[model samples]
Target: MNGNIRKNIRIGATVDVVLKKDQPTGRLTRGQVARILTGSATHPHGIKVQLQSGQVGRVKVIVEEAPSE
Candidate 1:
Protein backbone atom coordinates (compact mmCIF):
# COMPACT_ATOMS: atom_id res chain seq x y z
CA MET A 1 0.00 0.00 0.00
CA ASN A 2 1.10 3.56 -0.59
CA GLY A 3 2.13 5.40 2.52
CA ASN A 4 1.76 8.87 1.04
CA ILE A 5 -1.91 9.05 1.98
CA ARG A 6 -2.64 9.63 5.65
CA LYS A 7 -6.08 8.03 5.30
CA ASN A 8 -4.54 4.73 4.27
CA ILE A 9 -2.26 4.70 7.26
CA ARG A 10 -3.40 3.49 10.64
CA ILE A 11 -1.90 3.91 14.12
CA GLY A 12 -0.62 0.38 14.40
CA ALA A 13 0.35 -0.12 10.81
CA THR A 14 3.73 -1.58 9.94
CA VAL A 15 5.63 0.56 7.49
CA ASP A 16 8.96 1.24 5.89
CA VAL A 17 10.25 4.71 6.63
CA VAL A 18 13.31 6.82 5.97
CA LEU A 19 14.53 8.63 9.02
CA LYS A 20 15.40 12.31 8.72
CA LYS A 21 19.10 11.66 9.07
CA ASP A 22 18.96 8.76 6.64
CA GLN A 23 17.27 10.78 3.95
CA PRO A 24 20.60 11.36 2.27
CA THR A 25 21.24 7.63 2.12
CA GLY A 26 17.71 6.74 1.17
CA ARG A 27 17.73 3.90 3.65
CA LEU A 28 14.48 2.30 4.73
CA THR A 29 13.66 1.22 8.24
CA ARG A 30 10.78 -1.07 9.10
CA GLY A 31 8.64 -0.85 12.20
CA GLN A 32 5.13 -0.62 13.59
CA VAL A 33 3.67 2.88 13.68
CA ALA A 34 3.26 4.33 17.13
CA ARG A 35 1.92 7.77 16.30
CA ILE A 36 1.09 9.74 13.17
CA LEU A 37 2.75 13.14 12.96
CA THR A 38 1.34 14.33 9.68
CA GLY A 39 -1.84 16.32 10.03
CA SER A 40 -2.64 16.58 6.35
CA ALA A 41 -4.77 14.08 4.44
CA THR A 42 -2.04 13.74 1.84
CA HIS A 43 1.60 14.70 1.45
CA PRO A 44 3.77 15.19 -1.58
CA HIS A 45 6.50 12.95 -0.22
CA GLY A 46 4.82 10.85 2.48
CA ILE A 47 3.11 11.04 5.84
CA LYS A 48 5.39 11.40 8.83
CA VAL A 49 5.08 8.94 11.69
CA GLN A 50 6.80 7.78 14.82
CA LEU A 51 7.55 4.12 15.06
CA GLN A 52 7.18 1.96 18.14
CA SER A 53 10.95 1.64 18.11
CA GLY A 54 11.26 5.34 18.84
CA GLN A 55 12.20 6.25 15.29
CA VAL A 56 10.55 9.20 13.58
CA GLY A 57 10.34 9.54 9.83
CA ARG A 58 8.18 9.70 6.72
CA VAL A 59 6.57 6.46 5.64
CA LYS A 60 7.63 5.12 2.26
CA VAL A 61 5.65 1.92 2.05
CA ILE A 62 2.83 0.33 4.00
CA VAL A 63 3.99 -3.16 4.88
CA GLU A 64 0.85 -4.23 6.71
CA GLU A 65 -1.87 -2.04 8.08
CA ALA A 66 -3.42 -2.74 11.47
CA PRO A 67 -6.68 -4.63 11.38
CA SER A 68 -9.75 -2.51 11.82
CA GLU A 69 -11.35 -2.62 15.21
Candidate 2:
Protein backbone atom coordinates (compact mmCIF):
# COMPACT_ATOMS: atom_id res chain seq x y z
CA MET A 1 0.00 0.00 0.00
CA ASN A 2 1.00 3.58 -0.56
CA GLY A 3 2.07 5.86 2.27
CA ASN A 4 0.29 8.94 1.02
CA ILE A 5 -2.77 8.23 3.10
CA ARG A 6 -2.44 8.98 6.80
CA LYS A 7 -4.94 6.26 7.58
CA ASN A 8 -2.69 3.66 6.00
CA ILE A 9 -0.02 4.30 8.58
CA ARG A 10 -0.48 3.19 12.13
CA ILE A 11 1.62 3.61 15.24
CA GLY A 12 3.12 0.17 14.88
CA ALA A 13 3.16 -0.10 11.11
CA THR A 14 6.40 -0.83 9.32
CA VAL A 15 7.32 1.54 6.52
CA ASP A 16 10.13 2.88 4.40
CA VAL A 17 10.88 6.60 4.62
CA VAL A 18 13.33 9.08 3.28
CA LEU A 19 15.07 10.99 6.00
CA LYS A 20 15.23 14.75 5.56
CA LYS A 21 18.82 14.60 4.47
CA ASP A 22 18.33 11.56 2.30
CA GLN A 23 15.48 12.89 0.16
CA PRO A 24 17.81 14.02 -2.62
CA THR A 25 19.47 10.63 -2.68
CA GLY A 26 16.18 8.71 -2.35
CA ARG A 27 17.56 6.73 0.53
CA LEU A 28 14.95 4.57 2.21
CA THR A 29 15.10 3.73 5.89
CA ARG A 30 12.93 0.94 7.15
CA GLY A 31 11.46 0.81 10.65
CA GLN A 32 8.27 0.53 12.62
CA VAL A 33 6.28 3.72 13.03
CA ALA A 34 6.47 5.36 16.40
CA ARG A 35 4.12 8.30 15.86
CA ILE A 36 2.06 9.98 13.17
CA LEU A 37 3.07 13.56 12.73
CA THR A 38 0.88 14.56 9.84
CA GLY A 39 -2.65 15.61 10.64
CA SER A 40 -3.90 15.62 7.07
CA ALA A 41 -5.64 12.67 5.49
CA THR A 42 -3.19 12.67 2.62
CA HIS A 43 -0.02 14.35 1.60
CA PRO A 44 1.55 14.78 -1.80
CA HIS A 45 4.90 13.86 -0.34
CA GLY A 46 3.55 11.11 1.85
CA ILE A 47 2.82 11.20 5.55
CA LYS A 48 5.45 12.35 7.99
CA VAL A 49 6.12 10.13 10.95
CA GLN A 50 8.57 9.27 13.67
CA LEU A 51 10.08 5.84 13.40
CA GLN A 52 10.76 3.44 16.24
CA SER A 53 14.42 4.14 15.61
CA GLY A 54 13.76 7.78 16.55
CA GLN A 55 14.22 8.90 12.98
CA VAL A 56 11.76 11.42 11.61
CA GLY A 57 11.00 11.62 7.91
CA ARG A 58 8.33 11.60 5.23
CA VAL A 59 7.11 8.17 4.28
CA LYS A 60 8.16 7.02 0.82
CA VAL A 61 6.50 3.65 0.75
CA ILE A 62 4.63 1.39 3.09
CA VAL A 63 6.42 -1.94 3.41
CA GLU A 64 3.70 -3.28 5.67
CA GLU A 65 0.51 -1.44 6.46
CA ALA A 66 -0.90 -1.68 9.92
CA PRO A 67 -4.06 -3.73 10.17
CA SER A 68 -7.27 -1.75 10.20
CA GLU A 69 -8.93 -1.50 13.52
Candidate 3:
Protein backbone atom coordinates (compact mmCIF):
# COMPACT_ATOMS: atom_id res chain seq x y z
CA MET A 1 0.00 0.00 0.00
CA ASN A 2 0.94 3.69 -0.22
CA GLY A 3 -0.35 4.71 3.18
CA ASN A 4 1.11 4.52 6.67
CA ILE A 5 -0.56 3.51 9.86
CA ARG A 6 -3.72 5.45 10.79
CA LYS A 7 -4.22 6.98 7.36
CA ASN A 8 -7.27 6.87 5.11
CA ILE A 9 -6.17 4.98 2.03
CA ARG A 10 -6.96 6.07 -1.50
CA ILE A 11 -8.48 4.10 -4.36
CA GLY A 12 -6.13 1.69 -6.19
CA ALA A 13 -3.85 1.92 -3.20
CA THR A 14 -3.48 -1.38 -1.41
CA VAL A 15 -4.30 -1.55 2.32
CA ASP A 16 -3.73 -3.86 5.24
CA VAL A 17 -7.12 -3.96 6.88
CA VAL A 18 -8.17 -5.96 9.91
CA LEU A 19 -10.74 -8.58 8.80
CA LYS A 20 -13.14 -10.69 10.77
CA LYS A 21 -13.87 -14.45 10.58
CA ASP A 22 -17.64 -14.50 10.24
CA GLN A 23 -18.26 -13.53 6.64
CA PRO A 24 -21.25 -14.52 4.52
CA THR A 25 -21.65 -15.17 0.81
CA GLY A 26 -21.90 -11.48 0.10
CA ARG A 27 -21.02 -9.71 3.31
CA LEU A 28 -18.13 -8.88 5.61
CA THR A 29 -17.18 -7.53 8.98
CA ARG A 30 -14.40 -5.15 8.02
CA GLY A 31 -12.24 -3.21 10.40
CA GLN A 32 -9.34 -0.72 10.44
CA VAL A 33 -5.96 -1.47 9.01
CA ALA A 34 -3.94 -2.51 12.00
CA ARG A 35 -0.73 -2.42 9.96
CA ILE A 36 0.45 -2.86 6.38
CA LEU A 37 2.53 -5.98 6.06
CA THR A 38 3.35 -7.16 2.53
CA GLY A 39 2.08 -7.33 -1.08
CA SER A 40 2.80 -4.41 -3.40
CA ALA A 41 4.07 -2.39 -0.45
CA THR A 42 3.12 0.48 -2.68
CA HIS A 43 -0.25 -0.12 -4.41
CA PRO A 44 -3.49 -2.04 -4.00
CA HIS A 45 -4.17 -5.42 -5.61
CA GLY A 46 -7.64 -6.97 -5.80
CA ILE A 47 -10.64 -5.35 -7.45
CA LYS A 48 -13.41 -6.55 -5.12
CA VAL A 49 -12.92 -8.29 -1.81
CA GLN A 50 -15.12 -10.23 0.61
CA LEU A 51 -13.02 -10.30 3.72
CA GLN A 52 -14.12 -11.85 6.99
CA SER A 53 -14.75 -9.79 10.11
CA GLY A 54 -13.54 -9.61 13.74
CA GLN A 55 -10.20 -11.33 13.08
CA VAL A 56 -7.29 -9.03 12.45
CA GLY A 57 -5.78 -9.88 9.08
CA ARG A 58 -4.01 -8.41 6.07
CA VAL A 59 -5.59 -8.07 2.62
CA LYS A 60 -3.86 -6.59 -0.41
CA VAL A 61 -7.01 -5.30 -2.08
CA ILE A 62 -7.76 -2.09 -3.92
CA VAL A 63 -10.30 0.35 -2.49
CA GLU A 64 -11.83 1.34 -5.85
CA GLU A 65 -11.05 2.98 -9.13
CA ALA A 66 -10.49 6.71 -9.05
CA PRO A 67 -13.64 8.66 -9.89
CA SER A 68 -13.57 10.37 -13.25
CA GLU A 69 -16.53 12.63 -12.60
Candidate 4:
Protein backbone atom coordinates (compact mmCIF):
# COMPACT_ATOMS: atom_id res chain seq x y z
CA MET A 1 0.00 0.00 0.00
CA ASN A 2 2.72 2.46 0.93
CA GLY A 3 4.77 1.67 -2.13
CA ASN A 4 1.75 2.14 -4.40
CA ILE A 5 0.97 5.53 -2.90
CA ARG A 6 4.54 6.68 -3.27
CA LYS A 7 4.70 5.56 -6.88
CA ASN A 8 1.50 7.45 -7.69
CA ILE A 9 2.66 10.71 -6.14
CA ARG A 10 4.05 13.42 -8.39
CA ILE A 11 7.27 14.88 -7.03
CA GLY A 12 6.65 18.25 -8.68
CA ALA A 13 3.00 18.40 -7.72
CA THR A 14 1.82 21.89 -6.69
CA VAL A 15 0.88 22.49 -3.06
CA ASP A 16 -0.38 25.29 -0.85
CA VAL A 17 0.13 25.94 2.84
CA VAL A 18 -2.72 27.15 5.04
CA LEU A 19 -2.35 27.66 8.74
CA LYS A 20 -4.58 25.31 10.71
CA LYS A 21 -5.74 28.06 13.07
CA ASP A 22 -6.25 30.95 10.64
CA GLN A 23 -7.67 30.01 7.27
CA PRO A 24 -8.54 33.35 5.66
CA THR A 25 -5.66 35.49 6.86
CA GLY A 26 -3.01 32.89 5.94
CA ARG A 27 -2.10 33.05 2.30
CA LEU A 28 -1.13 30.06 0.20
CA THR A 29 2.17 29.71 -1.64
CA ARG A 30 3.44 27.46 -4.42
CA GLY A 31 5.42 24.44 -3.25
CA GLN A 32 6.36 20.91 -4.14
CA VAL A 33 6.47 17.79 -2.04
CA ALA A 34 10.15 17.32 -1.39
CA ARG A 35 9.91 14.08 0.57
CA ILE A 36 7.34 12.01 2.36
CA LEU A 37 8.37 11.87 5.97
CA THR A 38 5.66 10.05 7.80
CA GLY A 39 5.20 7.56 10.64
CA SER A 40 8.49 8.60 12.11
CA ALA A 41 9.52 9.37 15.65
CA THR A 42 8.74 13.06 15.22
CA HIS A 43 5.84 13.15 12.77
CA PRO A 44 3.19 10.52 13.42
CA HIS A 45 0.35 11.68 11.21
CA GLY A 46 1.14 14.56 8.84
CA ILE A 47 3.64 14.75 5.95
CA LYS A 48 6.46 17.27 5.51
CA VAL A 49 6.46 19.05 2.16
CA GLN A 50 9.36 21.21 0.99
CA LEU A 51 8.96 24.19 -1.31
CA GLN A 52 10.97 25.13 -4.34
CA SER A 53 12.14 28.37 -2.69
CA GLY A 54 13.86 26.27 0.02
CA GLN A 55 11.10 26.94 2.54
CA VAL A 56 10.18 23.76 4.43
CA GLY A 57 6.92 23.40 6.31
CA ARG A 58 4.49 20.72 7.40
CA VAL A 59 1.68 19.83 5.11
CA LYS A 60 -1.18 21.78 6.62
CA VAL A 61 -3.30 21.43 3.54
CA ILE A 62 -2.87 19.49 0.31
CA VAL A 63 -4.69 20.25 -2.92
CA GLU A 64 -4.34 17.55 -5.52
CA GLU A 65 -5.17 18.00 -9.17
CA ALA A 66 -8.93 17.71 -9.44
CA PRO A 67 -10.14 14.97 -11.71
CA SER A 68 -11.14 16.24 -15.13
CA GLU A 69 -14.48 14.99 -16.28
For each candidate, what is the lDDT? 0.94, 0.91, 0.35, 0.49
- lDDT string for model 2 (1-69, tens) is 888999888888889999999989999999999999999999999899999999999998888867768
Please report how far candidate 1 places residue 47 from its true position, in Å. Answer: 0.2
Which tens-of-lDDT digit does each residue in 1-69 have in candidate 1? 998999999989889999999999989999999999999999988999999999999999999979889
Instruction: Summarize candidate 3's per-residue lDDT along 1-69 as a digit string, tens digits.
Output: 323322334333334443334323323333443333443433342222223333444343334423435
Error of 4 at 15 (Å): 1.6
Model 1 Cα displacement at 57 (Å)?
Answer: 0.4
Model 1 poorest 10 in a row by lDDT: 59-68
Of 1 and 3, the candidate ranking higher by TM-score: 1
Ranking by lDDT: 1, 2, 4, 3
Q: Write the per-residue lDDT of candidate 4 for residues 1-69, one digit (tens) a residue.
A: 111233333456566644344445765565766655444434432355556666654554456742335
Q: At residue 49, what lDDT does model 4 achieve?
A: 51
The whole-model C-alpha lDDT of candidate 2 against the native structure comes to 0.91
State the lDDT at 14 in candidate 2. Answer: 87
Models, CA RMSD each: 0.8, 1.5, 8.9, 7.1
Clashing pairs in 3: 14-43, 14-44, 20-52, 20-53, 20-54, 20-55, 21-53
| TM-score ranking, best first | 1, 2, 4, 3
